[model samples]
Target: MTSSRSETAYQRAVAAFKNPTLDLLHRRYAPFVVSVLSVMFTAERPTVPISDAHVEVGTFVEELRAAGYDLDERTLPNGTGRDICRSWARVGWLVPQITDGVELYRLSAQAVGALEVAGRAGGGRAKVSRSRVRTLLESVEQLTQSAETDPALRLARLRDERAALDAEIALIEAAGDELDPIDDDQLLEDTENVLHLSRELPADFVRVAESINAMQRDVIAELRRDERPAGEVLREYLHRGEHVMEATPEGRAFAGALKLIGDPEHIDHLTDQLQALLGKSFAHLMTPEQRGELRAIAKRVEQGVQEVLQAQRRASHVITTQVRTHDPIRDREVDELLRSVMSGLQAWVPDSRAGDRIDPLRSLPTAGVRHLRQTVSDPRPPTAPAPLRDPGEQAEFVDADTRAWGGPNYAELEAYLAGLEAESFDLAAAFAGIGDAETRRPADLLGLLEIAHRNGLVESAEVSVVEALRPDGTARRFAFGAVTARTLKVESHD
Candidate 1:
């Protein structure tokens, strides 16, 4: 009797061959199927339970028909097309059975052996789907057609494909060019031919151009590092029949690489070479100032080198020394002495044509002192009398006793004299007393007469007493100098 498991397995196998999804499942399960068959065939009894076979087949198919393979849908095989069960049987992998009127199929022992052999050969898996094969074939055909019909596009594609060719060429050319002009270097010849071919060729030549240019740059950079003049390098490159200004990678790389290195010596040499070249190429191209500045920079560099050498010597000596003493006091003393000397020198130095001159007596008594001394020694000679223009203008001068005890409304003058009691009695006090009087007549007359009698305000009158009488009638001699307006001056002396 045919078991349900065997019947189910046959039906599943047939379905897998008919349906596209099932077909993908079959391909996925083929490895497992082969593995199981190998185990079965290796067994002396050569028998695999229908349930085990069915489980193995289902698991393998499910895995093979995963989303990764895009094999979800199933398309049924038509009547004339191949189906799973018939295909397996025809391939001698399975045999049909009719037991108890129930149809079933089982894997034949010979079929299992064949599967083992096929698995060993790594050919047990099914082939790819027909649709995918067809798509790939169609893509190849379209690509070929496009290449044939569109020349420009095809050339662009080629340029993209061979982008590095130019850079390589430029490198070879630049290196060959740098060698002392060779007679027949194949590399140089080849480079020239490549350049010429690239110019005429229809395919994109940018990549080839770039590569050659980069190679050229590398060559120039190497030469520069060896201390060759950049201009000389460039000139030699040009002499080899290459345009330095064109979009050649070599030329650009050479210039850029030189800039990157930035060696001062190389820059100086190159600058001079360039100037010379420019002079030859375009006479009167550079200004005199430009030339001068370049020379000056060179001179500065030489000076800097000398300075560096000297500094290095000093540094070496310092490094070798063992003594370490820091004397702040000594340093300060030296600084002070230096400062004094500088100050003295500055003092003696004439600031203008007038020479260093000193004021005659600016350091003498200040205004307050001089005023005090003058006030004490000689007060203003009363108020000086207005000149006696007319003899009639002269007012009669009266003695103190002759004058009224409470003099002519001189309250203000008396008050001023009272205030002067605290001050040093001198010319200023005398002047203040007389000037404050309500009656200027007597004061003015007295001041004029006193000035005339004493000859100067600062002079004192020497009074000699004939005799000093005692109350008992005994007498003695006396002498004194009175500081009065009698010793006054109308004008100050020089």
Candidate 2:
């Protein structure tokens, strides 16, 4: 007769989400909120404590400025950035954490859902990867019911799979029994799928941590309630929270992610295969910078996961301490003391202080609409807030890669090495010609040695000096030595 709990929940969720003003957040406050979150969520490690909040705000403002935001860092109110954090908290996208009377702010579980929606809705603006479909298919195949419980359905599915397998086997076992290996096209798609999944590891871990944090709060609240002894409640919720973290959907997903990141061999293999794939057919799919990111992604993902796991450990200790000293003796003592005090108060008498009051009820106004004082005052029109307008700046956010990829990579350096033909290598002169001075530090003299070793072209070498161009369009000189060509090789455009 009544709507189901889930349906009721859906209705409540819809009502809660249907706020006109709140919906405008993405438009009005998105530049600040999204940029900060973009960095906060994706940053390798962020500790935005109250101690650093002031400085962090200024740093973020500077970053935005570098990104061409026209807003003045100085003009921003002392408390302007903190207000956004508070606003997010009010909107349920952030949770303010407290530990031992200290406060910390973090993203709520819902924030991930919001970010995911934004990413799906073209906010990310990344190409719709070919790997997505493969990911979906693989997910379905892996997650489908197993043979243990749904034997009949499993049998049917297995039979269908067997049919497909048989077809493949037949093709392979035919006349010559030669099986066609997955070719470049399949390899491209497979590499993409792997990269896509690997890239998602950090974000997935962040969201899982968010979810676990939500559960931990719930557990703490349940344990702190006076309905039962604190120890019992704490113990119960601790076990439950641990189980949920270890066994539930988010937990399992996190565990799987951890497994992928935690295995050094797997990471090494993935990196090597990815590098190999990138140098081949998949090369065109990604930038040199992106390739670099994929190569180093495993360590970053592992660090994020470890941070989350460490947080869980800290939370466990916090919950234990919260209920460790709950004693029924102290509770009963307080209760009996309260009862005795109440009995004494009941038995004792007090002098009346009510004798001095005038007729309070009679002094009040009895008129419904008449005899009330009326006053009129001049009214002025409400003034709107001053419009904030600075033509938004357009400078780009620069990073190490921006500086590195600005000029060249090892490949380019090697090419430059081959291009030298004055009977010996000229490291500085070659790099100078290629405008790679600022890109590769002048102090990195070891690069010349590396190039020779890699190509096995150094039968002899010596330190030499030359000048190169800086990004500021100035020439700077450096000494990086030279190497003789051991093998006969010419500069190939390839």
Candidate 3:
């Protein structure tokens, strides 16, 4: 019988598989049996070994066993081999040709195609031929027939077909360097719709669309810069439109300025010059309160600068004097002693008389010694004897007893006390003549007090004592006990 075109291909594929160089083994079963088995294998049959005819028989029996067929391999006339042959014939891997009581089996042509395709698919040294395609198509046809009632299977098949068509279209387009006109029209329509939507949208949406339009325009302009005949000027127009849509008044002004000042480096300098000119020309442009506030701030800054310079000068003088001085310790001792004595007198004297009597004589050693003996003796150590005096002397005295008992040790003590007396006398005279003497300004007294305090001649309290003297003639008393000479010196100065 003359073979159909597909049948011819199948025969050719089978012939290739049978070639010695290909090394594909098939059973020496009947041609019909072999062909049937081959077609089944090609149709996605489970994997199995293909040997000679008896080997195929063996494989058939095993498959029967796997499929729960209850035939006994050993009990058959030809053992499992004949049973496999029987099973193959039953399952149509083989077909039986019977005459009278005798039966013969032949391989099926479909089975031959199946075996050839299966061998090639499994890397079995056989190349796929035109016959394999026909076999695969035949198998697909059979599957479609079998799954006709399954919606999911039908959908999967349709999807696979659509994917294949899509891939084919893509390959054709790529090769021809031509896009589909339909897709191009669709894209143009999409672009127009997007623009329309952007125009009709809410403010925030319009802003986002404007930004996207700007980006698109920028991209197009950059592409155009490559000298390609593209929509460069159109893109710039689009960008301008986006800017107009999105810009605030300040943004517009800034944009105008940026256009005017094209050079970024000079822009800052230009801005500064403009600001200065504006400030000069528009001084009246500011409100009265605003101008007042500005002036106040300027005044405060000026005052602050003056204060800083003054403090610096004072500090420099202090440091220089400190460096030049022989004994800071001696000065401190004198100031403390003076302050101590003055504080004592301030405590004992009435407020009215306190300023007149105590204030005037505070820095005098005579006044200090008298005040100390009278007011500050209580807290002195018992071991410290009273300041001694001459037997006939009426004034408060500093003899052996007084020297021993007065706060610190004697030799050091008398020296500090004497220093205190001298400082106090000078300070008292200075204070008393403040208004009368050109050199004796209240500022001079304050400067002296500041120096005395800075030099550690007296505690800060003693300086406050002077301030409390208050040319108004009221005395201010503060607590002190066993005071140092530094405090006494401060009191004397006050």
Candidate 4:
């Protein structure tokens, strides 16, 4: 290679390694970061509530410290998990978001990329496997066939594929009763290849979503700046917003993925195939985590797609709304006023001294009124406070009686709910599972209802009864529509 070309290539390599994704992999605590992230985020969960994440991270730090890891302030951050997470956000490894008024932490595209790299390194697979080579060959052949302009060549290729299919079908029919299934080795190779490819989808989806977000922010910033004509800005942003999936290489890959598995049928087909694969004897060779990942692949893809779609919709909505509500004149006036104030401050700062005192205005300038009407009502007591009742006349009640009449035992109920392992269960069943008599009262039932509502439980149209015994030894059956609590899997660093 020429000297100039060599220099150019070296510069490009340097630039590539300098990105946040590579920086994350090259950091001193890379393994720690990647391992914690992998444990906290999974296919079933992509976002964690900030508070839970902070607490989990804090616990992990303390555990590690107890295990004698040097986590000094100089080597590793010494503050709480909240501080660590905040540092990550500042550095673009974690993105903090608010969904439905709850603060959540999501892995950034760069962090996702770093985690992918770490996962691939730990997978212990050869860089080039038989299945991977076969996939590449098939892809190249398909591409060549599609690119062929000559009718004769295309027809020949089609005829060859048809003949091969027919031969395979004939062979299968002839050996129907004595057919040999694929060996475990080949099945394992193919499954691993599928997993390697499937695992890449999350990173790609995150990258695409982040790209859309960046574009949205850029569009908004440009609009607020009022530097360009409204017509031009609107047209440009509208087109970009509508076709955001074509704007970047990652976006195009996302578009391709959407085309491949956008349909519910395609996703169902994928799930069915995974189930069939797991049913095979070769599946025993795979680890439990691998099997779980395969089972949840469809759900992961569906959720990822939904997230990207939501991001796109939000971007489009924000752009359209900004355009619709945009007032260029008002914006310009505000901008000018801010500039004037800043210019005055800049001019005054040079002549000002730190110790100089200035009068402070404590309140806003009053609006003067010439006439005022004063209205007053008679301060007489209304009906003499209904004569105080005698303490003797009040019904005597003990602590136990008051407790029975009080609200539900929310803390105890919450602890019970947390201890359950089921993904979902009927309200009646959960109530029945309570072993403590005090926890099975009517108040506890009401507490369960409140907890369920807070957790967004599903209510059924069919009625379900939960019988409760009060402290007074009286039993009462309360009838309400059935409710189901669907427990979400908590992603923790434990």
| Best candidate (score: lDDT) | 4
Q: Compared to the true structure, candidate 1 yields what TM-score? A: 0.15
Better of 2 and 3 by TM-score: 2
Q: Candidate 2: TM-score?
A: 0.48
From the highest TM-score down, the ranking of the candidates is 4, 2, 1, 3
TM-score, every prediction: 0.15, 0.48, 0.14, 0.70
- Stretches off by above 4 angstroms in model 3 are 1-285, 288-310, 339-494
lDDT tens per residue, model 2, 259-307: 7666767767766775676678546766564565566666666666775
* Stronger candidate by TM-score (3 vs 4): 4
The lDDT per prediction is 0.43, 0.59, 0.43, 0.85
lDDT of 2: 0.59
Flag the better candidate by lDDT, 2 or 4. 4
Clashes of each: 25, 4, 55, 0
Q: Which runs in model 2 stand beyond 4 Å of their true positions?
A: 1-27, 40-43, 46-53, 62-108, 112-130, 142-204, 218-224, 246-248, 255-281, 325-494
lDDT, candidate 1, at 213: 34
